[model samples]
Target: MTEIDVATKAPESNATEQPAEPIESSPAAGPAVGEHCVTDRPTPAGQVSTGEIIKINDVEVYVSKPADYPHAPARFLLLLTGGTGLKSINNQLQADNFASEGFLVAMPDLFNGDPAPNTTTFASQEESQSLIDAFKLRIVETAKSFQIDMWLARQTEEKVLPILHKVIDGCRDEFADAIKHGDGIYAVGYCIGGRYVLLLGSDAQPTTPGPERPADEEAGETKTGPLIKVGAVAHAASVTPKDFASLRVPVSLACVENDALFPDDVRVAGEDVMSQANLEHEVRVYPGVPHGFAVVGVYEDATIRGAQATAYEQMLSWINEH
Candidate 1:
């Protein structure tokens, strides 16, 4: 088992729109989105997969259904995209991976098809390989055409949470006939997607400052319950102290070494917040691998690959346990 090390902290918008979108940083927020190069690739060969591209809210979504299971998958998982803005092949493979494990996966295109003004579209792995694989993507400047932060600004929590809810509804409606009783929706987020997933699992927390502020009697607005049953995040970015503070559901966070986005200070400070909140949570540090390794790392070294695999298993075990 990986050693757990996370805690909690702050919030940004009213839970009104649990932004898959990045809002302005509060005092407690982590680092903002970074400029990274992500390419779309097919699911690696030899793993059974059946995935379909569907549309929800006029945006394209990749839905992966269980391929091998004793029974129909009893859980629903929203496989959120990282900095790649949803066309990422890693996201597709992740969706399939979860689906293969009896968790129906619904991954929406956060950026639709075009993430930015000068983005390049690689129709297949062969095409992407020409430039990115040619250079091993060692130089971030090679993919200078695509900037993740420029796109994240447009996909705010207000804009994205509704789509997430719609995805959940569609999944439920599709499976309504087959099963009525099962575990509720769960979320798995990576990179920028991690912040959103945490919000989805959050129970309502105090909006106003101070210890236990009263409800907003002016609007008579009572807080709502969380959107998912359980959640996990890997190498999350743009996460804040406030975001952790508001969380009330069980969550597990996987941290990477010297991450510019989820830096050491932010990660360590989170522990205090979660401890005070007394939330059921686990946070682990996977040394050696870089921040985006969980989603986008392509490693030949056995050790790095093993760490990635183990962290993934830890995520699944946590989800299953909850």
Candidate 2:
């Protein structure tokens, strides 16, 4: 069998307001109300005054919080991690933005050491050109190879969830008093990280999503699974409609309109799957942006920044609602 492709790839007001009008949750639908470059509110204030890297059970997570809120009560525990490759400057920035919104943000370096982001440059723009086609084929195969390795080794069971367990423990210790009152833990991921958090929604065992238990889980399990109150992802790669089959919590997916790696079909499939499962979810495609716009392009383009802001608000709104 061919390996599946693994593509190389914020919060609002405190006052409660009327519920947002639901966006279309199906792939075949057209754009929704807030899916465009529309910014009706002021830029959210960045309350995060401190940004530092902290160790959580030996795993390094970039931690950010309000200087005054160091011990302030948390509203939720946020596990924010970025895309397909290594962490980037922008990833930290994205995390900081969420932290500013008053969550106890924990963005972990799941891959251990920093690795370079995947790079691709095409020789031609023509759709029928052999060079372009070959390049596209290579991307698919490469992404597939990467996803296979991830599924075999770095998935939630083997790596991320374990890290999250430790990180949550560390947060409880670090914010001993404040974290005690948080409503719940929420996650926001980009690209590959997005895929991981989505996988958390599944009841199936990680690494191997099946009924057969791994040797470690053969005996009745003692620890609880990663309990995410809600999840939101943007331009996620390597996830499919089937992945959402058992997701019990609400999710908000922010898709890029022109993303080559995760295009309309992928977004539509996710919508279809979630709808079929009768899951509470929303799908919004930001118009005219490519993949990775939420983080990388937020600083480079005003239009992208606008889209990012909208996605950020919508994510927070969804989390707040649930």
Candidate 3:
């Protein structure tokens, strides 16, 4: 199988051309947690391995188009990676998987090149009494090393939103020109990345950051909105109920039972909030799994493997239906 290597001509931050929509420079409040998924990820079957890495200002973005890229029309998919950053094997695999699913995928280095350490490793089978215990140890190790509170301060919503906005603007400009009429934009966030994706979807109207643009640029066409039309998250971290308000866009949540970042109380509250938000939303629980189950979870366990596969399928189903 050959790889599809193509770089997106993502615009520079201070590009002269105005963005499709104004990106606001607001930081998300609260202690956002990062799920450090550190397991090895083999490329999926029939996946077009290797995506292009494009540099836009200070950020590095991994771009992956569908297997039959350039030949077939497809929707744009923005993938948000967890604490391990964009280059993590799992993240790369995730991008390729989405691309194989016929999406033009763009995964930016959320940590700007400096990703957190891969601290999530299980103890030896001999050391741990049971398989589940081994998996639990990895979860604890990851939590301790990440110091998520500190990481949040450094990469708050304020700092990260601007970068994402820039990427979204660039993607909209570059891909929309691919065909006469481009398809809609969608987003799927894993663990830490989920918080940012939710923030972008909540706003009824999100403006671009920096200076005010002219009226013609301010006007947003329904199809050309840089904001994600549909959003999905798997075992997300640091998402508050206030952020949930079901959001303005369609959303689907894949949650795990053993997640500290998103406890049972928070999950129930979020479900209630979304239930009343009057928006299209779905929240499904995966029992007996950890926070990173959807991304870099231990596939050895039958339960974990099954949940992981279903979570990924749910992500695809959400986008397809909505």
The RMSD of every model to the true structure, in order and in angstroms, is: 8.6, 10.9, 11.4
**lDDT for every model?**
0.65, 0.58, 0.68
How does residue 177 of candidate 1 score in lDDT?
A: 32
**Per-prediction TM-score to the true structure, in the order listed:** 0.73, 0.65, 0.74
Q: Of models 1 and 2, which has the larger TM-score?
A: 1
lDDT of 3 by residue, 1-322 (tens): 1221111111132244332222222254355564344343443455444788897545789988887777877778889988778777668778888888878888988887666655535545574378788788778876766564555568766667778878877776677743223356789998778877887786533344444644554342112332777888887876766666426777888887656777766666665555444456777777776677787434567777787888899889888776
Model 2 regions more than 4 Å off: 1-49, 84-87, 117-157, 176-179, 207-226, 296-301
Off by over 4 Å in 1: 1-31, 35-49, 68-73, 116-146, 177-180, 204-222
Task: After superposing candidate 3 on the true structure, give the runs of residues whose Cα lies further than 4 Å from its correct spot.
Answer: 1-48, 123-148, 177-182, 204-226, 296-298
The 10 consecutive residues of candidate 2 with the worst lDDT sum are 31-40
Q: Which pairs of residues have clashing backbones in candidate 3?
A: 22-207, 22-208, 23-207, 23-208, 23-209, 27-157, 27-158, 28-157
lDDT of 2 by residue, 1-322 (tens): 1221222111222123443333333454321111111111222355223467878788887776754575666655465554332245556666667777777677777666533233333233556668778888888758755644444343334656566667767766776554555556678877667776776655643543346655556343322444676888877765555556556667888877656556566566665555555566777777766566565332445777777778778777776666
Better of 2 and 3 by lDDT: 3
Error of 2 at 81 (Å): 2.7
What C-alpha lDDT does candidate 3 achieve relative to the native structure?
0.68
- How close to the true structure is residue 45 of candidate 1, measured as C-alpha lDDT? 56
Model 1 C-alpha lDDT per residue in residues 1-322, reported as the tens digit of each score: 2443443323321234322322233565534665332443334556443688887656678888776543643566778876575656666777777776777678887655655333334333554467656676546545453354456566666566666766666766765532343457778888778888877776652232434545552232126578777888888887776577567777888888777788777766665556555567777787777566676345666666787788788788878776
